[model samples]
Target: MRINVLQHTPNEGPGAIQSWSHDRHHEMYIYHPYQFGNLPTADETDMLIILGGPMSPNDDLPWIKQERVLIQQLLDHHKPIFGACFGGQQIAKTLGYQIGKAPHKEVGWAPVYRQTDAIPGIPEQVIALHWHEEMFAIPDQAQLLFSSDLVKNQGFLLGDNVIGLQFHFEPLADNVREMAVNDNTYPLDHNDLHQTPAEIIAHGVPAENKQVMYTLLDYIANH
Candidate 1:
């Protein structure tokens, strides 16, 4: 199947997901709104994967508003979607869910406690990359799937096809390192969810997370 990745920034590319698509021989197209002018129609894409960025979903940027509309359109059609961090918040906001600052930002590697009964395909707990200051209320039509100590609303499922994750399941060791080097706006020292670069590197390799991501992709592919 063809997958279209909506990349918000140059640094935050579609890490492991891109590799998975390539290995599966799936057609993967990237649409970087920061570089591209507009989003494509639903007919032009089979699935949508929205990546993370430094920007918030509530940002007043014109492209953000346009992307929200496109997200809503994909939802209206029941098209499969997988979003991370800010992308997740955008999906929540477009679905009439509330988006706001969390008590604190979750940075580095953290374990997300899965409400397994809520989502059949996911595990009980998964070590995911966290790098967001904002959180969202689970949409009324969606089912809560996961939660973390720092962020309660870690993930939600809209219908059987669409999924939003506050944590980054697609993080590679390089991605975590890039985040550590570039993200200075959010102070991570006092945050309970913060982790050291060594800790993140120890577990953030593609081999460690590939099965988990593949399971998610399989769920999306089947649903």
Candidate 2:
């Protein structure tokens, strides 16, 4: 299967998603719309994975608008999509939902509770890394899948093929460190929900975290 990842930045790559693709023996392609502005067609992409970024979906940038158009096309064709952070917000925006600032900026590792058993392999509560100040609203027809203390709409499942997660389950230790170093705008000023840079990189990616990401990919691939 061709798993195409729409990467928004250089630092935030596919991370554990690349490992999962390699383990599954699927071809993985990463496109940098922020750089070359290249994107794959829905017909050629078997599965689309949207990575996290510092940019907002509300940005009036050309590539951002173009990415949303591609997402809409994929949705129209019933193609599978898995998005994290800003990518999740893109999916919500394409579906006509509003995107805005979260109640509080959730950074570093945090606990997100499973809201439903529709998608198996997700625990009742799992600790996942988050680094977003913006949030996606749950669409009317989408199922609320996860929620955190700071953000109520942490995740949502739209149809059987599309899944959006507001947290990072795919970032490894190095991925987290790079993101923390490159982005210094995390709202960690006396915020209880926000973790410091030192604390964020201290704990490496858990085995269970990678497994959960793999489970999500497998579910999206097979379903």
Candidate 3:
């Protein structure tokens, strides 16, 4: 399978997703739109994976709009699409759903409760990394997949091909540490749900947790 990842920032590159691609021997391509602008051609992509970012979907950035156009095209073509965090919000907005602030910012490793039928190969509750301030309403056409104490719409699925996760399933321990250190300006001190860098890293990345990510990618590959 050929997987194309749309990365919004250098720090949030495809972490565990890249490991899955490598172990399966799938061809992987990355487009850091933050650096290169929107250059991926829809025709060249088979599976699309959009990673998280600090920016909101409604931000006036040029690439945000351009990526939305690409997302709509991918949805129309029925391509398998997986989006995380800001990417998930973009999917919701493109599907006619509203995106806005959650009651609180959910940062650090939080348990995401599965709400739909079991995801076949994945677990019910997983401690996934999160670093977002905004959340979105599940699109009317999507099946609610997962939820958390702080965020009700943690994930949703559209048919068998499109999946959107509000949490960070692709972050490795290193990625989490990098994000916490670099993005320290995130209202951590002001918010009750926020965690310190040492606290988050102390939990570390679980092996089974990473396997769940591979299972998701495997499902996407076969779909």
Per-residue lDDT tens digits of candidate 3, residues 119-173? 6867778888878778989988888988988889999988888888998888888
Cα misplacement distance, residue 161 of candidate 2 (Å): 0.6
Q: What RMSD does model 2 have?
A: 1.3
lDDT of each: 0.80, 0.88, 0.84
Mark the regions of model 1 whose C-alpha exceeds 4 Å error after superposition: 118-121, 184-190, 196-199, 206-208
> Residue 134 in candidate 1 has what lDDT?
83
Model number with the top lDDT: 2
Could you give candidate 1's per-residue lDDT for residues 173-220 as a string of tens digits? 787677666664453466566566556556555455767777777677
The sequence of per-residue lDDT tens digits that candidate 2 reaches over residues 1-223 is 9999999887788899999999999999999989898999888999999998889988889999988899999999888899999999999999999999888878778889999898887888889988887899999999999999888999999888999999899998888889877775564664557577778888667778999999888887887
Measured against the true structure, the TM-scores of the candidates, in listed sequence, are 0.91, 0.96, 0.95
lDDT of 3 at 22: 93
Residue clash pairs of candidate 1: none
Measured with C-alpha atoms, the lDDT of residue 34 in candidate 3 is 77
lDDT of 3: 0.84
Could you give the C-alpha RMSD of every candidate to the true structure, in order shown? 2.0, 1.3, 1.4
Model 1 scores what on Cα lDDT?
Answer: 0.80
